[model samples]
Target: MFPIRDHNPSGRTPYITYTLMAVNILIFLSYVGLFSDERALSRFFFDYAAIPARIVTGDGALTLVSSMFLHGGWLHLGGNMLFLYIFGDNVEDEMGHGRFLGFYLASGIAAGMIHILSAPDSIVPVVGASGAIAGVMGAYLLLFPKARIDILLILIIIFRVFPIPAWIMLALWFGMQFIGGVGSDPNAGGVAYWAHAGGFIAGILLTIPLWLRLGGPGFWRRTDGHPPHPEARYSTSRIPKVRR
Candidate 1:
């Protein structure tokens, strides 16, 4: 199951979120040509992506931020952008533009550091905005736990959309990350589960102050863990068949 959209809508335009998506897309496009050449791609990732071993040796420190914008492939970019598109607006709406950008970057940096600590000797390059996007998911969970999210569930040939609380989806996602992190080798160079998990925790922690300022548990009581705006309702359109 993957989230297709959320019921909650932000009151204002989410300029920062849109800008972020555009920047990521543009950066990914710049490297699209390198994918066909294995050696060239490897060199590109090595130079820009975050490699734990290189960080451990006190080098490539800037990659912690750079790698967040670098994705492994089109699917990588699409998935991350989708999540950011679905959930990022509300978070940015709550935190305002400048603060949200800072929160995103800080969470990403925290994620990279955690990943480096998890596999300090691993030479494989880690790249993607997943870690940072995981942070946005974390914030969304805390701020709008009861918000309805529409998920597209595919089973064989059956395709259906189901609406569920945000907490359930995010909780399941977080649980899977932990399980995957434990089951896989940190040196294997696959999904950076730890980074995702770390960014999630960091986002929650960073958002705590804002949550408390809004009245902590009282905030939940006021909004009932949903966005402080009218919820959007969706309807399915039916196609009419022509009589032959």
Candidate 2:
């Protein structure tokens, strides 16, 4: 299950978040056609995607930032964008445009470094905004633990959308990454679990000062772990049961 949206919305317009989404989308579109040719696609990723082994050799240092804007496929791009859209706004609103952008890029770089540490010899190319978006998720969890998030659950023909506390969802997601990181070999990666986990941890660490500036635990006591603004309410949707 994944979040469809959140009940808490930011008070200000998240221009930086929207701009980030646009840039990621446009960059993915610009290179998506290369998928038609395996060699061409591989070459493209080699030039732009973060490779742990390349990083160890003191090369492709820039790909850590460039790779945040690249995606493996439509679904990969869509999922990361969805997450950023949901959690990014409030974090951006809290950080403001300039600081949030800096935080995001820093998270991505930290994530890449963690991945390199996990598999310095691996040649696999990592791409996607997930590492950066994971940072936003990290920040969101710290700032709004009690916020309501609607999760879309799919079980074959059964489809459902249900609201749950953000803490439950975010904690569960972080746990999954930890489990995956422990169980999978980083060199033979399908998912960069370490990067996700590292980025999430980094996001939280980076946001701590801001949280303290807003009053730390006292802030939570004041807002009850919700956004310091009115929470949005959404209507639930259900799929009609098919009669046999």
List where candidate 1 sits over 4 angstroms from the true fold. Answer: 236-244
**Winning model by TM-score:** 2
- lDDT by residue (tens digit), candidate 2, 1-244: 9799998889999999999999999998898899999999999999999999998999989999999999999999999999999999999988999999999999999988998999999999999888898899999999999988999999987799999999999999999999999999999969999999999999999999999999999999999998887977677888887889
lDDT to native, each model: 0.94, 0.93
Supply the TM-score for candidate 2: 0.98
Error of 1 at 77 (Å): 0.4
Please state every model's RMSD to the true fold in angstroms: 2.2, 0.9
Q: After superposition, how far is residue 101 of candidate 2 from its true place, in Å?
A: 0.4
lDDT, candidate 1, residue 192?
92
Q: Could you tell me which residue pairs clash in candidate 1?
A: none
Q: What does candidate 1 score on TM?
A: 0.96
If scored against the real structure, what TM-score would every candidate get? 0.96, 0.98
Off by over 4 Å in 2: none
How many clashes (backbone N, Cα, C below 3 Å) per candidate?
0, 0
* Per-residue C-alpha lDDT of model 1 across residues 1-244, encoded as one tens digit per residue: 8898999889899999999999999999999999999999999999999999999999999999999999999999999999999999999999999999999999999999999989999999999999999999999998999999998887885677889999999999999999999998999988999999999999999999999888989999999999998999899523355578
